[model samples]
Target: MELELVRLPNGVRIALDPMPGLATAALGVWQRVGARWEPAELNGVAHLFEHMAFKGAGARDARQFAEAIENAGANMNAATGYERTAYYARTVAEQAPFALDLIADILFEPHWAPDDLEKEKGVVAQERGEAFDAPDDRVFEQHQSALYKDQPLGRPILGTEAALKNVSVDTLINFRAMHMTPERVVVSIAGAFDRDAIIDTATRRFGGLKARPDPEREAARPQTGHASETRKLEQTHLVFSWPSPPAGSDQLYAARMLSEIFGGGMSSRLFQEVRETRGLVYAIDSATDTLEDDGRLSVYAGCSAQHAHEVAEVVRGQLELMAAKGPTEAELKRAKAVTRSSMLMGLEAPSARAEARVSQLFLRDKLTDFAELRARMDAVTCGQVQAIAAKALEGPACAAAIGPKAGHGALEAFGAK
Candidate 1:
């Protein structure tokens, strides 16, 4: 993939990747501010700010703003993550100007109002409640607390109800003014579009953004633990974590393979041994979360309350076995193929490309195109996988489980014996 990158005098970046015959385009503004950017008092304010951005901006109120884009075709909506907030739009190639204008309006010209804040608080609160009510989601929250301790990274993106109540209009506006600056923003567009026209539109919309320096964000504090609590639920939800490589490191390639082979797919060792073989879990998988300074390779399993202890033991044993013996050459080959297939499939969509581009640039200030990324994956060896598994095992393994079971959600109390 060829990239056309430009930095405006004000420090805002523009990345354009044109797919010649595609009929639609996706453009998004990626900002380097999220829950981690907030202080303890303002736990979920970043997310609230994201909600408020859509409440009103410029002349179009939230309803009109959404209508304009939907009328033009933006089936996909904006999203907020732990490290960034993205406002993106997809529309006909010719509607590029309108889409960018509307998205930029959301990103740069939010109409902060006390009324909107009061109303949106309820919506955000409801969303938070829903997340807490779901056992799968609750398990991850418990896991985050165990893995990140009292740090902001452990704070839920939706934040607590108390935090939302404390957020006033001034806090919202000031936070945006401080973090939503040119130097910390990346504008990315992909699919069929006029490059020159898109550039001019971005400059006009974002050029006036001040190059205000972003304050240094708090680094995520790493943590480890083994604790569980009782919840009157039907099935047990388990989230276990170990050490892994940070983002932008070559070890990430190996980490990806480790995660996949560990418990990723149907044919994975854990899924085969714990589920198909033992009927231990209804759903099980391995996932990784990598930040600039810290990372985790975690496995999640939802099983009958009676089988929680057995599931945990099997998972631990799989890691130990892999570390000692390493993945077979056939397993290594399959992992690489699965990873490549997933990446290639995601590339088929313009929005995916836009998100990938912004993420790479925001995290590392460089985009590793398909060829480079493929080469990295292609270069991973079984030795690296074994070494990663061994090092991961050396770290404290944290376990968090939520369910009403024989042990009342405590996997450790269930007796490893």
Candidate 2:
């Protein structure tokens, strides 16, 4: 794997990882700001800004933006995450430069028309409603809100209906100016391509933009204790979140391994014990989400209203067992192998590689080679995994459950137990 980092005269930084013989190239422009950076009044501005980017730019309107890329036989899309927003394209190796230019134009030249803003407000409002109607989605949102409490990081990415309604053209334009700077952006490319030519084109196009000072971000600290809510639905969706180490910590890897062992796959302990053996529910899993300053380890389950209480106890029991006895040597080996193989398989797609590179650069400030990542996963031992699990599950876990009002007792009992 060859990695080259280039800085344009205007301050845009581009990183290229060239993999020879791959037919398709993945490309992306990632901004440093996301939902967490928005001011209280502009809670959803980052995501709203992402939508406005496709409205129009340069000589291309929204339709033209789509047509121009499809004309080149490329697939393009964008996504907004907690801490970043990314615009991406995957195309034949030769069309990679055009994709990069299109992305740059959209990012720097979006024409935020008042008419479009009005129309988009309705669209985002509908989106907000849709998300709220989905029990699973609302449950996660409620969990994050409960876990982080008053922190900006705890807010929903889709902002409230009132906030989305009030987002004017000027608001989005001001947001663009504050957060969309070359210094905070990263352009990453992967696959068969001329690395130097790609960098040169990106530099020439994006290098003209002036860099702005990085915006201030709120420092996020862990919120201890528990929170719960009751709702009306069929199956209960429960999420248990506990504070964990921030990204780049050695414990982060251990926590990930622990998640895999506990609930990662069909063969994982949670799946086998909860869903397979007990027939407790259709889905059960655990995940570790680590940020720059703080992180969370969550165990999620969807179960019948009647089984909610028992399932929670079983899940906690599994954690307690892990804390006491630790994972066996064989289980640790299998979990590590599973994680390493999954990582290797995911990189086969150029688009995945591009996203991975941009995420690493933006979130962790470190470029990780696949080999090094695999080695790190391989180095996690059973003892370290157990210790991390014990630390993560030691205290009162925050719980959020959404289902029929009848199921509230089960959830409340689970928390109390």
Candidate 3:
């Protein structure tokens, strides 16, 4: 993949990925600041800011902005996550400039009306309620809270109702002014496009803005504990987390290998032992969540409340076994194949390529081409995977469960240091 990068005088970084033989392009503006960067009082301001972006920006009202993008045959949306907030649009290659301009206007010329602000808060409150209403979402939120504890990282991305009430037009404007500065922003586009024209447009739209000093970010430290909420559900939803390598760590590839072997698919240990053999769970899987400075390896399962304890034990046992004996040569080979195949398949889509560029820029402060990313995955040995698995057992585990109380104690028991 040939990725082009250009930096404006104001420190706005632009990355362009030219995918040959494609007629459409995917593009986004990514800000490094997210839910984790919010102050205690402004817990969900980052997300609120994302929603407010579409309410009105530049000369376009909400309806006008929607119409403009649709008139151009483009789909534009935005998302807020724990580590970053992204505004993205997909369009035919010829309209890439228009998409970028709209995103730039969202960033630099947002207008949050008083009525809009109040209405958005109500919308976000509903969003929050819908999220917690799902058992899986509730369990993961509990798991994050258990792991991150009293920090902003632990808080829900949808600010609490009380906190949502505190958000005003000034809140969105100040957040944009402070965290959406040139240095903290990255504009990336991928797929067939006029590279020179896109770069010229970016220089015109994002240039001239002054850079600001990056705000202080609180370093994340995972805490160990267990939390649970009882609900009238037939199945218990459980989540388990252990400390893992950070996004920029050398051990990151190894952690990925460990997750794949542990519970990545039907062939993985958790699925085979906990689901196929024992029928302890309807589903079980493990994955890694890595942030700039820290990360966690999480395992999740849904099962009868009576089997929750057994499922948790079996999951822990699989990790211990992997740590003790390491993965077989066949397991290692399969993991590498799965990891590489997934990456290669994803490259066919412009959106995937755009996301990869944004992720590398924010996580590592530089572009790591696909070759290097695959090489890192390929270089991980069985011993390295084992070491990462062993390291997971060294920390206090974080656990969360939703459903009946019968299974809740199992999480507490398993989570105890």
Q: What is the C-alpha RMSD of each candidate to the true structure, in Å?
A: 2.0, 1.9, 1.2
Q: Tens-digit lDDT track for model 3 on 204-268? A: 88887787788888899788788889988999999998889988899998999899999999899
Tens digit per residue, CA lDDT, model 2, 120-188: 877888988998798878888887887677878889897876677668888887888888788788989
Q: What stretches of model 2 exceed 4 Å from their correct place?
A: 9-11, 225-231, 414-417
In model 3, which runs have C-alpha deviations exceeding 4 angstroms? none
The lDDT values for all models are: 0.83, 0.81, 0.88
Candidates by lDDT, descending order: 3, 1, 2
Q: Residue 401 deviation, candidate 1, in Å? A: 0.7
Q: List the residue pairs that clash in candidate 1.
A: none
Score candidate 3 by TM-score against the native: 0.98
lDDT of 3: 0.88
The top-ranked prediction according to TM-score is 3
Ranking by TM-score: 3, 1, 2
